[model samples]
Target chain A: MAKGLDIGTMNIICSEREEEDVVFTQQRNAFLELDSSDLTETMLDSAKVLYIERDERIYVLGEDAFKFATIFGKDARRPMRYGIISPKEKDAIPMIKLIVERVLGEPGYRNEVLCISSPGEPIDLDMNPLYHKKMMEALARRMAYETHVIDEGLGVIYSELSDYNFTGLGISMGAGLTNVTLAYLATPVMSFSIGRGGDWIDEQVSITTGLPKEHVCATKEKGFKLGLEVEYGSADGALSIYYDALMTYVIKNLNRKLAEVTPPKVEFPVALAGGSTLPDGFLKMFERKLREAELQIDISKIRLAKEPLYSVARGCLIAARTHEGEEIGSGGETEEGAG
Target chain B: MDNTSSPGILQRGALIYYVGSVTFAAGIALLAVGTAFITISRIHYGSEPEKIILSVISTGVGTTLILTGINMMMKQTRYGYYIVGASAFISLLALLIFTSNYPHNWFYPLISYVLTLYIAGFLALLGNAFANVILWMIEGKPEAVVGREREIKIYTDEEIERDIEEATRKSIELSASELKFKEPGVEEVKLGKTFRETRGNITKVKDDIGEAKSLRKTINPGERMKSGSVEVESVSRNLGEILRKGAVQKGRFGKIKEEIKDEMKKFYSSIRVTRNR
Candidate 1:
């Protein structure tokens, strides 16, 4: 049983690992982060597994419920899913039980409330009205309090503060989605994703090289950065394809949004956050590509989070604190009529 | 979803190679059938031009097969290249034997023999190249997608209050004389020493990770940790510092208002169901 409730925010990165050949889109650089990876893993880790596919990629999400002969854990088992319901109702039982245990920490937790957060835009723009609420409610059953969102641009705020105001683009990269938060006025103006983040990168690298995803990741860890010619002809040039494809969105879709956002007072910069952005120089590559496309954005102004991975979660904490009537430090100009 | 073709230079090249090899093979097979028909019946398969076309058809079939094989080979098709190569060689050898068998048929046989030999050689090379191309295309197993989701829990109302309280204290840079120590649940007691000054000395009191092991150790004496006597100031001296720094002011007009409102909602929401109970 876990006592202290661990809270975090995840800017879901739609890496190559999560999507197939096709890259997912970054929703207005909206954040799709979560409080913990544990809750997601629960529905996915155990027995029954299910997935969803939208926009050419497959998503293995909702884990099935299972008869809990008594199962629990603090560390991850493997391969948690998120899309929809698992094979059987019972498949999700074990995971749900673990969520319960983690929040309540043993028998005294039958009704301890749990609060979670989501990427700002997706939850708001979900075509399915109940899609998000249902997902949050499903989570609520395991814990007590369930909050889907902390506040818009919450994570970006923490990231900007960490980076001394977007000297660079702050990317909250994750699996299934990637959120880009661009801060110029020491606050986020807008963020968008080019899809094909870490997961897709991993998957493409493995498939193209005949190597396992884990091996590729290990190699990436060893500084065998993608976009370079590998031992076998760049495995059909995954990185080249990835960058060209993804950058198009950054150029076409996101650039347009950036143009539209007329910042009134402050000049924010670019910074990156999230696990996907944790890789060394991902920000630089993105910046370079954007520049090459003649967007002519200044790369020197880019800022990387001191701890790229934890920025989003910490931002959620900031969000939580703000909700408590506590003060959150300031940076960017506030949008008029924004609730 | 960004709907764009994966069609890049290499993909386009591969597609062109595929189409070429397939058409080449189909054409050669037709040519081979034409040759077989004429060879079996000694009759002109068609008019003079038609007979030539028939012969060309057979030659084309052989050429297509050879080309397809070679393309596969270029793509690193281990087996396809070998098979194509072998078949092309066999066809060449067969053409050689047949042409040679018609000894002394003069110029026509010689020309025919040379043509057959050329077809065989070309086909063999084509097959080998195609095979290589196909093999190279074998990137073996495709990679799998790895999904990641991180979850963090929102604090209950009481926990939020505690965090806010602690954060407020930490925010202030206080003097040594202004510090005090407060004890459990209620009441503030001043202890003229600053927690900051004693924090290095306060190492024995582990930060409240609330671990079972720590709880066990605290209960036991061998660990030499603080017992019931451990205390810190309840009223943080940073209160005045907050006013000076204006964190409150910044948080209010800037981002903190939204953040506070959000957290307060979560806190109350957590308390909501429990109150119902």
Candidate 2:
């Protein structure tokens, strides 16, 4: 079976269709480093946690790294920053490669089809998405997979807007960047990104509230909700305020960009997907912001993805399946037999 | 080519001509005076020794001036007339002064000076006129004009129509050849058809997948997370509990702090941190 991968800033998720179900495997795309010693190595060996040993030192990886960082009062480091490989991290590529390998595992067959979701080029940052796309494709190819890169926002459309003929706007509120795609009849007409997302909100809230970034991130992930009105006295409240600001900025830019194009004469539903959109009442806040901005397009509805965090991976799986089917058909094989 | 427009060259030539005329006039006056001096010396002094020397000197001076005047009249040298003119004028003055004060008294000297001056002036004028004539002949020729206008040729209607028809025919032929050159080959036709079909198939498949997604209910991430059994759930819960307890137990800050510390110890033991750089 083909696999779909979402190499997100926060997590690396691999999805595969097993029978009638979609199964996902994920690894935290983060790490923490510590001075190496005999005792430390023994402790790490005994704990059996995911780690990499390099240059006479050890790197604690995955979700456990953050736990260790909190105890040590040190910040957990991410291999990815702002949705691409962190340029400052010396071991970013190697660490990401290890995580991707663990999450995707070995291909079931040689040259197995794999569709990877890649973020659109950022409009507000000098980051090159092409390098990231090529790197991920190279990684997947190394694992014996025939890889394809899909736009992160378009992947959201493939996952959530199948009923709309893929003609709506898809916004993936990821941790490092908010990817926006406007599609018409399954074709992407415009795709761009703003370099602000969950991480930015957490960072702003952390700074404003004088709390550790880890604590802020933990608070946000632990079922925090943003309402029409926020309580300014609490950390969650601070986070909510920032979330609103981010939504407002995104909407304003979206409207400005949309104004430049001649939109098709069809109503489009705005679909929000990604880890940042997991907060409660996020759909309502987004809808309110869009209405307040008075965008030019006819938005039918604003709905959240059933599973925001896995939508990109699921969309990638869908694309991979379709691609596999096409390959089979072109090779003179029966589609039903291939399925 | 117009003499009036280029005054510099013409002005120099005219001045030279005037100088030559003056030289010629002065030479004739000197020759006349020398002849009169010799005739008076012979008639009145009977060729006395002192008078003979004076007559010979006067004749030699007159002969030199006449030769200079003839040379200045030629156009062989540039500014040659100025030399001749100055010499002739000086000699005429000298002769007039010498004859006026010496053996010949005021009457003979006065008569000789007046006749020589008048004759010199007249000959200079005549030479100047001839110089001008020569200059005009050399400079006023029509063929010497530097720039000349060319005649424009006009075509007949028949010729113009024939040229237009020829150009149109050539252009039509070129267009026909270009069209033939750009005609699609068999391979190109097949390639284009395959490309279109592939594009259509891709669109169809995308639509099919989108339709399929729309029919499904909202995907529950909680269910998927539970199935994956990721370590984030435990970490998030533990961290959340500590933060929540810390916020709630503000009055027992010390106890909450100890509890947090204890919890961190337990969590850190299960994980490992290292510096890999």
Candidate 3:
């Protein structure tokens, strides 16, 4: 059996193939610490809030954390920032492990292959994702599964660009970082992360508006759209402003990064994925930016993934399927080492 | 006309321009008030030389901000970012000066510290706002800045070899764990359901282990020779026989080793090492 796990900064999603259809399970990668009290515990239990009690502190986990943070006007603590395990969050490891287990469930069988999406090396930040990837691999191993680490952007390609012979540009505008991959025949020619994404927008909006990061995040996720005029002082306005800036930054870097490489002479089809791209008019805004960028390479088309939020997980499943096939063909010995 | 500067782009750019202008005005107003406060206090209180020096410095900074703001508004160059950065630095300096000089009394320092913080906060906000606006305005404009290369990890040959060796070792371990033996013609029909391993797996495992052991011996024969003279003599004798065999003709064994070496180099060079992490 094969499974795909997209360990995103904002959400952890798992994909499992059941015959012809693929099913997905997701959990918000966030938590909130509330005061420990019997009444609070009773209230949380009555509300059915997903939480854990440790050392006399009630830590609300997953989607409920966002709700509680918004209620309390506090920022939801993230287990990951900028597409890796957050150094700022003290309980990132245990929290993320619990969240992953909740979302991924148990492996179908022992040594079931689990392909996890990991962000590529960042271009704009001095961060090493190896530690994050290894931690995730170890977590998967401890759960009694073989793990494969695939590039986040490459996962988008596998999910959305099969018609292009897996040759195209995949951009995952995730919460923590925008991962970009230019692939040919399912092989990544170039891949890197921009170190800024939805979280950056939330932080920027929070700083500008004096709103808690969670409040800004809620506003952004609550029916926000790009290319629409909003009140300049409002949270949605700030979100839109930063979203524009983020798209421009991504395009500029894409142009510059693409210039450095000698890519195959093909009209590349670009596919966009991730939660950040789910906002209305996002594709149109991104297309506008791409047109303005006047990139040196030919772009055949710009398309959004059918399900941007699940694309990475689905792509991971595709990869895991192929990897499992290869392992079977090789008599249970894969060329790639266990990650 | 080029689509790069369409009405939509211009409208967006214009909005940012106005925002930048407003932020610049607010920053200049704060700096102007700060400069006026310093001047008024220095003159009314007949301040010390240090106070006079600070007043002059504040005047210079206030003037610089106005001039830079005007210059940036006109030119919209990369220097706009530098101006905002310099303003921020000046704000920080003013805060440090105010706090250190007025250390004796909390009441006096608190008021000035709050004012400085307000100025610093405005400057920081302005810096961010200006950076975004300036970046938007300068879209697609190329600059020959150095060291902007993507930080993709390029592994050295040694690192690549180490990774391959690690993978091979894991493959060997997997082979060992999943190994199965079959006796020819002994319940051959029943073997179909229970034979979890393939015949080729055994052969491949044997070949890989034998090759690895031989390579290890060839690379570090001295380690084995250190144990005892008898072992050393045996290794020397084996080496002599191999040398004699190779001397007679370019044997398949020697050719295979050379081919493996060549293949290793090719593999190392062909693999594009993008994933360093």
Candidate 4:
């Protein structure tokens, strides 16, 4: 069986086909460090919180880490920031490795093809994704899986725009980065990322409202829709402001990038997928921004992925399946049988 | 051989060229029919995105093939082979897109027949290009080919493996020192002696003093003590020299500081004198 792994800043999701159904497993990509003690260890055990012990310290992982952070009034440390491994977080590598392992589990078979989604080099940041890509590859190889890296935005296209003949624009508004891909008939014409996303919104809102970033994030995720009115100094109101700004930034870059490349003169159906796009009216807000920008290329429609968070994983699955098919065609064998 | 020296259009090369041309024309006709089929499907389906996309792709491929075919026939140069090769690859890609669109419908008679026809057309296009390449190669290395001659080499598996091993060996030799330097996990302190030697020397010096004390019981205690004292004095003298060298370096630093202070004093006095004036 082939697998798809989406290593996002906020989450690590794995998608695989089991029999006739597709199974998705996920974990929040955050951890909280606590001083290791017998009492605390017993408490964690009683709570059944996922954690690992190293250097005499306990790291609470996944969603439980967020809960722990909230209870302690501390910030949850993320393994990634701005779509890549955080340089400031010393434990980013080990933390991400453990989370990916938990999410992916053991491959169905040895050397199973695992297609990983990697963000493109951000146009606005002086960051290179090569090291991160190689690190993910190394992790996958350590798990005895053959790995292939797919552009995160292109993965979205494969997941959502198959019916459009894969000719459209796919944008993943993730937590740390927004990836954009222009694909024509399954071929990526151009792809890039911006180093601003949900986390940026949370931070900006936090700064404006004098609230903790974690508190702001919690408020934003607590089912507030975009374009909703709230108290002037409230978290939701600040969130709305930042969300608008983020949309404007994305649309402006879209215009600037589209001007540099001549895409085929066809109306493109844009697919938005990621955690950031989950809020209600995100598509409507993005559509408004795109209309205001008045890009040269025609846009047929803009829609959200059915499962925004799982879209990249699903795309990776599709890509892995394609690769498996090619491998089978080339007379490669598996333990069970030829797929 | 000169072109005039060869038997005219009745030659095998000419025959293959004619056959390629005919096959290409037939393949193009089939692609045109495929486009029409796509259009009909779109009409029946109320212009669905997938059908429309398929129609556009088929029409585009059909148009490209026609243009390339005209270019090849009119130019009649080896460059036509290049165009044909590119078109053949594109047609195969188109076939892949077309097949993937309705993968489950391959069992349906209409879909199966259309797919078979498309495959046949693609093969014909590919075959035409292959035949043209053979004709070009067989006609002789013509002067009008207009480029540097190309060389194609085929290596056996063993030869390829040997070459790779040779390259790996060279790379390993080149990077040996880099790998060795990088192996130390922590930053190494550069010193005149290895840590082990420095540690062993200190222990040996202590052992020598202890041995001298032990010898005092067997020999003249005063003489043994004098020899041990001489050894200690020499060691202390070397340490004193090192300390003296460090003091000299510190003195140089102090001298530079004193010079700076004097310059500051002079500047301040000059300012005071001007103020007084």
TM-score of each: 0.36, 0.54, 0.54, 0.56
Output the number of the DockQ-best candidate: 2
Candidate 4 docking: what grade? incorrect
**Could you tell me which residue pairs clash in candidate 4?**
none
DockQ of 2: 0.01
lDDT of 2 at B254: 92
Model 4, runs deviating above 4 Å: A326-339, B1-277
Query: What TM-score does each prediction get for chain A alone?
Result: 0.55, 0.94, 0.92, 0.94
lDDT of 2 by residue, A1-339 (tens): 678899999988888766446777777899888776778776766666666565556677777788889877888889888889999998798778777877787899999999999888787898767667777887788788998988898889888887776678999999999999998766787788999999999899988999988888899989898876766679978988899899998998898778756788889988899999988988888888898887889889888987898888888987787666532223232222100
TM-score of chain B of each: 0.25, 0.25, 0.24, 0.26
- Residue A47 in candidate 1, Cα distance off native in Å: 19
Separately for all candidates shown, the number of backbone clashes (residues 3 or more apart, or on different chains) is 133, 5, 0, 0
Ranking under TM-score, best-scoring first? 4, 2, 3, 1
Q: After superposition, how far is residue B182 of candidate 1 from its true place, in Å?
A: 43
lDDT of each: 0.39, 0.70, 0.70, 0.70
Model 1, residue B242: distance off in Å is 29
Interface RMSD of each: 28.8, 25.9, 22.4, 39.2
Question: Across residues A186-290, which tens digit of lDDT does each residue of candidate 4 receive?
Answer: 788778899999999988987888998888887777798888576777777888889999999998888888876679999999999999998888888888888
Compose the digit string of candidate 4's lDDT tens values, residues B1-277.
1123233211123333354466558548857876777756744545665665566566646654654453344213434455466655665565665556553443467556655655555565556545545555687645312222235488778668856955784465445422211122433222111211211100000111111112222222232111224534555565555556656787576655655555444433322100000
| All candidates: DockQ | 0.00, 0.01, 0.01, 0.01
> Model 2 residue A70 lDDT?
83
